[model samples]
Target: MNEVFDYVVIGAGSAGCVLAGRLSEDGQHQVCVLEAGGTDATPLVQCPAGLAAMSKATHLNWAMQTVPQAGLNGRCGYQPRGKVLGGSSSVNAMIYLRGQPQDYDGWAAQGNPGWAWADVKPWFLKAEHNERGADAWHGQGGPLNVADLQQPNSLSQDFVEAGVQAGFARNTDFNGGSQEGVGLYQVTQKNGERWSAAKAYLTPHWGRRNLQVRTGAQVLRIVLTTTKAGLRATGVEYVRGGVRHTVHARREVLLSAGALLSPQILMLSGIGPAAHLREVGVQPVHDLPGVGHNLHDHLDALLVADAPQLTQSFGWSATGLMHMVQGAWEWHSKRTGRLTTNFAEAGAFLKSSPEVSRPDLQLHFVVAKLIDHGRQTVWGHGFSCHVCVLRPQSRGTVRLRSADPLTLPLIDPNFLAVEDDLQRTVRGVQMARRILAQAALARHGAQELPHSACAQTPGEIAQWVRQTADTIYHPVGTCRMGHGAMDVVDSQLRVHRVLGLRVVDASIFPSIPSGNTNAPTIMVAEKAACMVLSHAEKTSVAAD
Candidate 1:
């Protein structure tokens, strides 16, 4: 391993890939990226339909389960994070959403500068290569490919019609115009295959001599030194193939380890709450109490119904299995067919209460009866609609279980801790039922599952949601960006009270955005690249 580099980025996830690619573009900086997992070269990672199989592949997934929630009848929720080159983007549903503009404005209001909607839109465009071509809202010739799904199931189109019939506006583009309607989602796909962050950014730049990407290199801790200037992060100590190695960063160290692991890494480096550090047998280096605070995630509840036709739904029938076999051949040959479906294809963003300003409830219409994050099986063909609170009032935490760098961190989302969060979720469930009951969907002879359908009263619905709701795969804000006492990083994404270090990932979100987090996380990294480069330029000039 190299002893030193201009920049060392931890975790080659969505953010790290962008940083590695962009920072090394000038050919003047040596950038090294470390990933805990291996390459994303399998068909399960390249195909859009492979999400079902990939989600179950334990080797590629962190498979971290949350501590028993006080909500959900004390049932533990499953937390699946990708441990590969592209990180969660490799295994995600591949939906490309940048969230509402007001989400960024909200961040600016919360003490973060240059993160308002107007300020970050260009960053979004900078990293995008939309298939629809560039306009005022999108870009062309960018690394990330955003395109329409090659083949969306008829059931998904029916979902959009059903949503429109249920009194919602029809939106053809969620990224353009307002985000208050029903539509088919545009995915991060190229032609017919999945286009992950690694594929978009890092893959194209693999030949860059200044860039070094090492897989299966798990970072043990950030190597910090207490110099007279401050506690500076010099490099990171990582274990690769059972042997430990250290690589120093001559410029800065970027922590892109994600929400679940970034805080743990910081705490391990003695940069978190002093009491918690001492409890875990680590001496405190920097008493930054907010390292693991402000953790939150989107909790969603599914309302499912039966769809008897094998062609429209996925189930255990012989005919369904036959269709799957045919679909596989079709996709392999022409990259077209039912295999191109991203499952949660059509959806809506609606307000839970008319009095509320923006859409607070987000829905995902699935062509299958998804239960327990698709871990459990249902007997027959059916469809399901996932309803989640867009702006949850509830908050949670990620704390160290021990000082051991390899141990799993304790994740407590504290979902439904706020009564209003449960109330909003109940309203969301009612909305889902209304849309499913619309004639556009009812024509398929789909019947709502008896258990959830029977809950007519608000109390009954709340109780049902509590027993059933779980994560829709968005967890963020553990290492928030702001100027507050609890904020870990500032608007520039630099860790507070520390020099020569920064965190660029979902972990630094000041607050969770109003939609899917992948695109926004990528945007954050794009902007952070400029910040890091500007810092380096100034340093160079000062030295000259």
Candidate 2:
């Protein structure tokens, strides 16, 4: 017998966790959350510092690679997405940033009505439980905990000081009045442990009788039924433990599988462009041409410097190894120590040029030398700074490689496809170089690594950027929200022509934000939860 539910949410990711917790709150609706990966109960997930290792752990990370990009000298970039209960949140750097207000305003301007800064601010406030207490710009009592780092490396403070020395103001809160300065980043952590979306929303409601969470249940496709009204998503087919299970959704099916997988699921369910579906051997159910279009991400370039004299910095050495062992014990005992660090402890948002209206570039100053997203091992004490274009003109697609749901989708971010993107990135690199050269960092004996020091001229810098730049892991807009010819979902996050289905993750973002995307994604889920419940309430009234 097939199980039934009022809502079936695919992917127990950042958005899905929120949906599951909210939808089942009234204890009236049975909501089922399906996750492709297993548990997030291990120390690797709970510890904030585990992010370095998690990036390489295939069991926890999707570690998806993009198609060879012509722009980055035909190099395929690394894309690490979390596969466990919290999704990317379980394995991310945990920086809690909501981006600039104008970002959502831009979404509103692009025909997504309720996505303006004013419209979405309430959701952000509603979802946050900030450690610094409540104010006009923040909330005090909510599920997701946002707190300052318990123990940040001294180098991180030096980075912030260096930014101030480089002419940028020091901002205590990036999510506050302005996002245009440098400071220590507030993280999604509580008492030094990672406060992922799953930990915040789902874990607290684990005992809720109406909510069911299924791990290691990979959804194959949505089961759509054609009725007189339209094609409505009724259920889903999933594989678990070598057995297939069918579960019916009485009211709706919510796809929160994230930017990369949401559109993949839709296409596998035969709801993408007609021609592409046919080519992939999937029978077309809906001829939505925009299902997998408008893909873009923040392309980041790194500047590394060897800081062997800085004993506080993390690296491989007898002293560093001993510190790690001691820090682990300290974390295990009191949830405080160097192990509490998120690595990317400090960052800034700056304008690539003074003429720009808003900050168009972002920086992440890591306490350790991060080469290849921490996949490559570099033995020594050093620091790395990341500069990414806040917005790129380039766009790409997420298309089906095969009709099989298990097959990875063809991801083409087409980074640096536009010459303007490369130029902006070059400018960002120059600015970062200036910041690093500041007396604040220079006093700590920080010296530029060979790769960065070798690139001096404009031509050399641009060439170097093309040769080394890759994604900083913020991908969005594959199932973009808008009211245009290429839009996949409406302002309400409903699939353009589908019934009883919605995409409520970063995938629905009309455009990428100016900073990290996790906070914005949580806010999206908070707002989407209200929409889903409101519609259900009205439906119940009409039925009565």
Candidate 3:
């Protein structure tokens, strides 16, 4: 006998958590959430500073790599996704941002009604519980807790001063009326601890009888059936503890496995391009050509500098070691101190060129010399800054490596494929250099590392960008929502040709937003929850 659920959500990530939590609120629907990863209860996930270590924790991360990108001079970029209860929200830097209004307005213009900035702003507010209290732009009494860092590193504060000295305004709130300017970032934390989506949504509902969360369940495919109308998703097959199991969904199946895996999961279920499915040995069920197309991400270029005189900056030293131990004690005992800092504490949004209408480049200033996403070790004290294109024109794909569910998918971001992307990246790198050279930062005797110092000219900077640029972990648009021929989902987030199925995550984004994507992803789920419940009510009324 197969266990039945009114709704089966694949992937207990940012969106899945919200869907399950919201759908089961009325106690009328039996919601089951399936997560590929295990628990997110470890201190490594709860402590905000532990993000540096989480990047290299394979068990907590998918740790996938991309196919060689020509735009990156044939370098294979690393992509680390959280394999835990909260998904990437469990292991991210925790910066809370909702991008520019135009980003969502553009989505509405692309034929996705109700996704305009005006429509989505309320959802963002609904999902938020800003500790700074409610305002015209923010909300209170929401689930997710948003607060200022209890203890920000002095170096991070200096970075903000440097940005101001570099000619950019000093705007305090990026999510406020304007996003242009440099300032300290607010994070998704509560009392100096990370407040992931799971903590905000799923954790509180653990005792709910109607909601079931199954971790460590690797879904192989969505079980589809040939119905009287057309193909409909009936259930799903997954493996857990080396045993295969099937679960039935009486109403619908929601795929929220994120931008990369969501598309791969659909394609594995024979829902992608027909030819590609055949090549990969999966029998085609529905020919949705956009299942794995339209992949894009923010390509980031780093500028590292050696600032040995700045003792506040994190690095390898006797004093730094002592500080780390003390900070750990403070965080464990009092839940406050330097250990509460999300290293990329301060950042800014600026135009790469004066002619641009809005900010095209975003900066993340780290209090440590971060290299290779903090996987590689740099021995001395220093600082680093990352500048990424807010909206990239280059597109790519996510194809299957083989039919085996255990096999990872082939991910190609195809970064900088468009010449304009490269030019913008170069301009961003120059701007970052100017900020770092400013008197506020330069006072610490910061010297550019050899990797970035050699690139002085525009030609040299372009080559340097090709050699060094990589993703800042914002990958989206594989199963974009639109009315176009290539769109996989409709405005309501339903799979176009398949009934009783939908994708609710960053994958459905028509295009990438202007800044960190976590906040916008949560907003999408908040709005989707309302839509799902409303649809269920209408269906019940019609049947009655």
The per-model lDDT (C-alpha) reads 0.91, 0.93, 0.93
For every candidate structure, what is the RMSD over all alpha carbons to the true structure, in angstroms?
1.1, 0.8, 0.8
Q: Candidate 2 residues 1-544, lDDT tens each?
A: 8799999999998999999999999999999999999999998999899898987799999999999999999999898898999999999999999988888999999998989999999999999999999999999789999999998888999999999999999999998898898999999999889999999999899899999999999999999999999899999999999899999999989999999999999999999999999998999999999998999999999999997877789998889999999999998999899999999999999999889998999999999988888988888898999999998999999999999889999999998889999999999999999999999899988788888689999899999988888999899999999988889999899998889999999999989998999999999999999999999999999999
Count of clashing residue pairs in every prediction: 0, 0, 0
- Candidate 2: misplaced stretches above 4 Å? none
lDDT of 1 by residue, 305-346 (tens): 887774567776888888889988998999888888888888
lDDT of 3: 0.93
lDDT string, candidate 3, 1-544, tens digits: 6899999999988888888889999999999999999999998999999998987899999999999999999999999888999999999999999999999999999999999999999999999999888999999999999998888888888889988998899989998999999999999999989999999999999999999999999999999999899999999899999999999999999999999999999999999999999998999999999888999999999999997777798888888888899999999999999889999999999998889999999999999989989999788799999999999999999999999998999999999999999999889888888898888888999888998899999999999999988899999999999988999999999999899999999999999999999999999999988988899999999999
